[model samples]
Target: MQTEYDVIIVGGGLAGLTLAGLLGHQGLECVVIEAGEKIDRVDSVPDDPRALAITHASRNILASFHAWQCLPQDRLACFRGMQVWDENGSGAIAFDSTELGRPTLGYIVEQAVLQTSLEQAVRSLSGISVLHNSRPCDIQWQDDHVSVILDKGENISAHLLVAADGVQSACRAMAGINYRVHDYRQRAVVCVTRTALPHGEIARQRFLTDGPLAFLPMYPDHQCGIVWSTRPAHAEALLKMTEREFNQALQAAFEHTLGEVKESERRSCFPLRRAEAEYYCRERFALIGDAAHSVHPLAGQGANLGLLDAASLAQLILEAGVKGRDIGGRRVLRSYERWRKGENRIVMMTMEGFKYVFENQSSPVPMLRNRALNFANSFIPLKHTIMRYAMGLSGDLPVAAK
Candidate 1:
């Protein structure tokens, strides 16, 4: 859209759009390069099958930037409690928001709603531009600026370049960053389900031998967005079943915690993997969102982590700008990196640990984890700590999130 900008974000997904809006709001000229069509409020995109558990801190960040209002209020579901258990063990744990003197724990937001709304928010900003279907090629890093060659041969320059692309990020490869990847060897099968009983605004997860199965409350009280993670083979087999047969299997899987599953959509499945870059920043480039790190979906913290990354970087960049410092300088970029990497690493490691403990069937491990879960349930302070962590209310929150 322009030959130059203060910041050029390489993806227009949630992270990229949020950063663009925040930075643009702060008076920085920002541009987002996306490979897809220009999506905004006018786009007739249907509701996405996937929903994210947006922590309270993330909601604060969104509210700070005014993007929260762009989302449809009717489409949001707030969970006041959570129930988790091991299907093969006696360990069961429950958490309630009331313990923390809060009305709700967090919210399950439809992915498409937030993404489109964020894109629209960026578009509304005078200082931010969105270039859709204009793919960037021939990425080159310079000491003072990052140069991007468009497929049509138009060149653009920016003081900072951020890769907010998804897990399989082309920009990450272009920057020559190394990442550690672990395939959980599980596939997540997602679909909308309607049960005989209501979800009661409680998000539930059952640790199966294959993986964890989560039924997140949707906007409708009787329906849920189910993430059924299991081995790839099992996912495929489940996908092949008829709707009735599928509901039976689904009910059997969750042990009908919400009662008989009466209806379900055609299941969609994707492999689960945890990935993290060795370094988040290099020269004039930085990675955020799934491009920087992607964790197992068992915890639903992956997107929340990425959004925090965007907020942290945005705050740092704005602070640097006010000081007349080079936004892409190694020192500046490293500050953003240093601020985010440790917290992200902890989240990734925590997810991996959960994946390991829940996905394994080793007799002793289940009993131990179950005992721990039961013990945790019995301890009010421990449950509060876990709830705080899950709600993104713990740890070092960025300025925007705070």
Candidate 2:
């Protein structure tokens, strides 16, 4: 029951745990406080219908913490290519790993699998601890450190307090940080399905009139993870449909790209929104993962962005420690903010732009977008550039991500 550490991470999710592992391995003492049951034991992770798209860069960061290695090979699927097309018109674009001189474009993994592996990796590190079923009730900001008061009457002090909590981050609110959320007016219906035809290890996205539908390949050739973003009313209707009806609707929406889609797992839904904090850090406080920002699932970049935030912040903190400087100092934390804020904002805007262009059914706009897609597809240089950027292979990336 150590009361003090170099860093106290709020939220033992992927981002927080990843930070703990990175810092602990570099000789920094860290503790992760989570308001959930302890999940460090083997097979303790719960089931989740949500799937995450892990870019090559994100994989590198996880590999640095050795979490990627802990993942079961059978639970992971590599998508060697992606096919995107618009259902409104005859326009489509495709990206392949061969074009980028890579073996695979990225990976599709269950959210629970990723979190479990990351938590296990963090737990194995020497100077890191996880305190589950613990909630932070208050924060005492100091000149060089921060003290967190837990609901269970525990006081934990650290040089830095990083909020890796989810979208409604209580830590961010408690720290007086303001955030902006833009509701997409849609809900993403997620589930795992088995298709009549094999997925061919490729990911597919179709832009419908209302929103986008993505079929991400999962383990086993015929299985895929489905993210169908649509209006609330439509989403509710889909949820209420019979299994057979839902399968037919899904198959029709996807245009049978992989043949009939059978509901192989329970379905779930969540609202889609783009949220960002006004500032990334204040004094000894900082935000990471969904705590700082949440993007549309259209591009499947939320988890990847959060993982990058963790890596970037950890790198900066380790750099400050090596120089004998206060890792929680305003200067060090601001550096992390400056490094990721704009980059994340760009991605958010990109997602918004994609949403607007497709959702706009106005005359000429649809035709123009279709033309744009085709034009981009035929242009090798532009296509490669988009592939690199989307896959996170090109950017001012963190050391671990690179």
What TM-score should be assigned to candidate 1? 0.97
- On lDDT, the leading prediction is 2
Quote the lDDT for 22 in model 1.
Answer: 87
Q: How accurate is candidate 1 locally (lDDT)?
A: 0.88
Candidate 1, superposed: residue stretches over 4 Å from native: none
Cα lDDT tens digits for candidate 2, 267-308:
899999889999999999999999999999988899999989
TM-score for each of the candidates: 0.97, 0.98
For candidate 1, the per-residue lDDT at 146 reads 91
Off-target runs (Cα >4 Å) in candidate 2 are 40-44
Return the TM-score for candidate 2, rounded to 2 decimals.
Answer: 0.98
